[model samples]
Target: MRVFTVLGPSQAGKSTLVRAMAGLDKEAGQKLEAAGVVTLQPFSFMGEDWGAIEVAGGAENLAQAGPALAASDAAVVCVPADAEAAVLSAPYLRKVEEAGLPVFLFINRMDQTRDRVADVLAGLQTYCAHHLVLRQVPMREGGQVVGAVDLISERAWSYQDGKPSALVELPDGVRPREVEARGELLEALADFDDQLMEELIEDQEILVKEIYDVATRTLQHSQLIPVFLGAAEHCNGVMRLMKSLRHEAPPVEQALARLSPGGRVVAVGCMGELVKHLGKSVLLRAMNADCSSGTEMAGQAIGGLTMVAKGGNGSLAMGDLGRVVKSDHLRLGQVYLKDGARALPDWAQPRPATYRRLVTPVHQRDEARLSTALERMGEIDPAMEVTQDEATGHALLNLQGPQHLRRVIQTLKAEFGVEVTEDMVPPALRETITKPVEIHHRHRKQSGGAGQFADVVIAIKPLPRGSGVTFDDCVKGGAVPRNYIPSVEAGAREALMQGTNGHPVVDVAITLKDGKHHSVDSSDYAFRMAGKAAVREALGEAGLVLLQPIVKVAIHVPSVFSGNLVPMVSGMKGQILGFEAEQDAAGWDLFETLLPMAAQDELCSALASATRGTAWFQSGFDHYEEARRGDFGAK
Candidate 1:
């Protein structure tokens, strides 16, 4: 069984293409028809024939499609003609590459205005250095895209109404470029083998079988990206598409890792223990490590462990999740641990997932459905947890990316009855003290009821980073009652959180030196007042400075991107990690530097835009720095 994913921008005819290719409604049982040219159903080649599974355009669709595709033999990417729309394939392509799967590009909507086939050809040649072989070119007649010729088969097909007809001879009345296009395609396909090279060089006829074999080999190794020209709308060139997928696309690229059992449930995919993301499957094993179906997420699975062996090709297609096509001869599940697993620790919970903000309708009520939908998302990504802010009641999902965020909103409207929209919110930021400072809070309100009164004088100090809040009461004789100590700490801590710099306070310590407490009036409430006063007073008297979080990041940049990254990083007040000279086949350089987490504002967009989707990196918090101190801001 092999998995073929159809990737393209929304409404780029991807859904139409898949429906046409699968022959879902055909009474003739899945025949490949071209525009008045060919009615052909070649061989149906794939393992575990659960049939073609079509995934729609949405996050949930991706979640369902990901594992299915990951478990498939191949992926057929539908590239859109619009420049802006062409980007839809990027995320799916990255996911396929991570899964060790082979991918083929099918330039979609060829009937519409294409970006001069020469330009599309050139772009693919430059960026997709892995596998970019052109297998077919459009056949034009009367200045319209009437049909196309298969480069390997050397046959022309035309559309009869919407259905394809029998293979026909090449039309004579055609523009000069159409003939030239066919010759160019043949030359591209022939470059994969020496025999074809010799034939083309000698001006001799090359055997058709030889071309197919070479193209298949090149494509399997990802040396060929078979470009199919077609309008999925009219299903004109779709027959040839189905044929190309059957012959040239690789059978499967197995998940480099699998699930194994022993002392603990471990991830066995890709490199390290991390199972490369099979689309958006929930990690099988989470920190809250339970494997029961009720507890396990729908798309959720475990990753982030080591694999002892390289994977072989095989596939599985989930019914609701979709189907997998088999290609590689390797049987992975057999080698993995299907039993003898363990569970997570007693105190286990899912990881903290990030999300963008969403606002559902107010007058319209469907919160039950909204909650169910959000909970279902948890299966695809455990981190994609949901939370409704208490004050705002806003539906929020911690998402990984902008694409993921958009998909969630669409799912809400389409799947659930809730109408939801997203607004990318700037992450909540905090400021801390650059240096130790004395801050105090005082309160003495003597009114009618019991005459409440309290006075607290204490010392405020900052500790080393990450120590967290700690409080001590050093009242020698009973200046402040010992029983009210916890209350005082609470009051002081509260003031710290609402810092003068308008950021959270960190790495600070405070000591309650002395305070006055009345016999009847000096209750916990009185001490709380005293502690509050002391904190506010210390803050006013002791010098204060602003502090910010500094995140240590190790980025791998392609050597070519280093020069560009230098200026970009520095522009955001970032330090240039000069030790980025090394690079490999992945074309990566290792850079270690510290950046403000706050600087992460719009940083993801800038990085992706700069790298043109070819580069990505990870970041984590290192420590907090005194931002407003004397020269302390410099790294």
Candidate 2:
């Protein structure tokens, strides 16, 4: 059996196409409850069994498609018939190109669009690295697509509901268009085949087999992408698409060679993990060798193997995806070889997290359970991350966007039974003094027999940015005992934890100018209290300012949407640094700017809305700058 992955934007009919190919339901698009999850379906076409791995189509879920693509024989990219929808395919196309896999573009919902195939191809060409060739030209009647003329075979077929297309005579009105598209397809094939080029130049008749051979070779080499038109909902043109895949898609051995350079036996690709009722099951794709019960993988024996469509499989053959149960040693994105296990070289890393929320269990006693559930969720979806906020000591759930975070929260409640509440992550704010001030304090506590007596005078001064708190002993003639000086410094450092603004004080220096200590009553506790009280009095005298964290962000989007970025950034009170055209990515631009950490979530949401979810940004901590106290409600 051969395996191929179907990917596209959400609601582009990817799941519907997969279901149609499997002969399950032609109307599956209407009942798409599991649209954000990866599913595997099996089907038989022309006596050859095949598997289709349908990946989540949302832009936020693109990270899940990497492992699926890496482990498959080829990729079938399903895109809507609308021309503007082509931009949404950019990221998926890049992934398939990087994996060096043969890719096919299926123009779904052809019956619903009036746009010509030429215009759609032109829009997609801007993003694809490979030359796209139209394999079939749509045959429309009354402005509705009813059939397609195959460019390779020059045969015409009329679509039928819930069945294979019926053969039809070539209509005269469609002949000219068919000839033009066939010519273009031949020309594209000629670029990679010298013989075909000569035949085309000499105007000689080309055999169907000759065209197929050229198309197959060029496609496997990633030189050209063949486009097919179809309305998967009506089961129209699906069989034709399947026939093309069966003949033109690369074999399992060829896919293995592309994944691993040399021909090595016993290679298994771990696509992902599925948490089942029995236990955790590792989704495995056999790239080279057949895997069965007791097959040694990643230094662990596979207790059992189960197929996605068929249960209790005896053995998983090459190019087939199955689940391995009762095994805890396998990991996602890892390729198991005879020598050792290693990560898939072309596996995509998860995008940078932009949205964050502080998550806590509803019940305090379930904190441990929540932590365990989050750890498992991280393994299931690498795009979601769990981290600790240094300033507040809260567990922050970092995700690609709002939708990604919501899915995680839902999973925590439904799957793990760990109900939780979420809140916005607090900004890590800092406080600093504006000027220097001198203060004196005496911590005298006369309680019963032993009295606590200590005195100290300290001067506090503001320091430059990024210069953390500093302590200096400027006492003359040891007026304050040397042994007791360390305690006073410790107490002063602790006092800076909460300043007048209720934030940690930074960029300040304190000096021990003078102090009096009794030989019998000058204990560390007495001096510590004196130091704490002195610093409190000094901070009150000196004014405090709040500093907000600033981040340097790099935003990438199609150049067509570049104009919308400036205003969006300005609305967030950000400063634009500069921008330039992205290298190697045509029609795309990269912009750099400085933005406040508090507005990162808003920026992400705004970009998604403005760019139709085609824009993404990465940010890092730059520095801390003084901010308006009113912004944070600081007193």
Candidate 3:
């Protein structure tokens, strides 16, 4: 079976086309939401089984498609013919290209569009890395597309609304355009095949099988995209699209060859609610052989096996998607072989979450339930991360975007019965000494049986930012006992946890210069108290300074907004390093700067609004700097 995923921008008619391909009603299923993955019934293509999965076009949902693209044997990118051909599916196209999967473009809703096919194809070429060769050209009637001509077979078809196209002779009006498109398709395929190039150069006739072979190889290597046209609402041109998939898409063995060899079974998706008796449902993609119930997959018994398509059941052959149960060692996007597990490359890893929201139970009494609910949610949506902020002790849900976060929140409330509200994350700060200070302190207790007594002298100095807390013992003449000295250092370190500024102390060094300990009266406890007292005295004398955490941030936006960055970062007390053209993304600039953590919330929200949701930024902890008097509501 061949697994093909449909990816496109929102409302591109992706789901409808997928349903038509599977012989289902176009309007039968619910509209797709963020992270929605729908599997259609298995259908035969050239007498071989094939399954199709549709991925919704929401920006946040595209992150989830990366894993599916990596898992599938091929992909179909959908674009609406009626809308401006802005290549809104660029992100998905890039991901599919990176995965080295065979991909084809479906120009859907053609019956509603009046745009010239040449103009639409030109716009798509800007976003696609490789050439998009037109495999089929639209046939127009009464100034609208009524059918399409196949470039490969030199065949034309006239549409019968709500039914398969009826084959017809090449139209006299479209003959010249068909010949030109066929030549272009052959030229693109020839670039990848030396023999084909020689034949084309020699003006020799080429067999359809030879052209198809070259096209299949070119597509499998991601060197070209074959374009198909259709209005899935009327099921027009759907059969030809499936035929192209059947002939051009590579087999499962060849597709899985790019992945590590050890994995006989690989699972692309992680969420399924089947096989309750086996504890959890596990979806597995076969790479080498067929599987059945009670089959031991990767040393775990498959208590049950179910097919992905509707009414499809029984043993799963190579390249089929099915649900397995009773597997204890299974994980998301993992490859399991009889010997060991195979890891996916870095690109296959889920994208880092760009949006963060602090969450807490509305009633504060369902914290535990919230934790469990988040864990289950994470299990279901691997792209969405749920973690606790160490500094603020707040529950933070890091997701791809606001839409993805909203879906997770909705699931938490509706499925888990846990109501939560977004909360403000507190600013995290550090404390350090501004100047060095020397202090002497005595810890004497005369109200006890042994009457404790100890005297300690120490010097405190500030280190460079990020140096953290350091301790050195420079005692002389046994002034401080070796065994008692450890306790003294421990007490001093403990005191630094909450400095005079009520924050963790950092970048300070303490030296034990001299101290006196009575062998009979003074013990570890007394010396510890003396050390703590000495540190406190030094802190007061030296005066503590509040330091704010600075982050190294890189903001990527369309070049049009490059001028807005300086003022934007400066407004948040940020220091700009520089900016340059972003190499990975064309027509975009990358601005590098240092920003305080307190300003991150405003920056994230503002950037999206300013760039019309085209710009984004990522940050990492850089160092700590002295906070300005008025920064971050500081006193």
Best by lDDT: 2
State each model's CA lDDT, in order: 0.52, 0.82, 0.76
Where does the lowest 10-residue lDDT sum fall in candidate 3?
Answer: 25-34
Report the error of model 2 at residue 155, Å: 2.5
Best-to-worst lDDT order = 2, 3, 1
Superior by TM-score: candidate 1 or candidate 3: 3
| Distance from true location, Cα of 14 in model 1, Å | 1.5
How do the candidates rank by TM-score, highest first? 2, 3, 1
- Compose the digit string of candidate 2's lDDT tens values, residues 221-244: 889999999999998888888888
lDDT of 1 by residue, 1-635 (tens): 22355554346577677666655225212332211111222113322221343444432233334433433456666766555444345444444444445567777776676466656655444334354556666666555666776766767777654686357786665335555765675677667778777888899977778777877777666655677777777776777767666666653222222221232232211100111222222212121122222222222332222110111222112211111111111111211123322222211112223334655653356767677667654533322557775435767665545766665666566555567656554333444444455444456677778877676767777677778777887777877777778888988887777666555666668888777777776677777766776776666555556666677766554444556667677776677666554332233566666776656545556665665544445577777666633332322
Consecutive 10-residue window with the lowest summed lDDT within model 2: 26-35
Q: Give the TM-score of candidate 2.
A: 0.90
Stretches of candidate 3 off by over 4 Å are 24-41, 44-47, 82-87, 140-143, 166-176, 266-279, 309-313, 326-328, 358-373, 392-396, 554-591, 602-618
Pairs in steric clash, model 3:
none
**RMSD each, Å:** 11.1, 3.4, 3.6
The candidate that wins on TM-score is 2
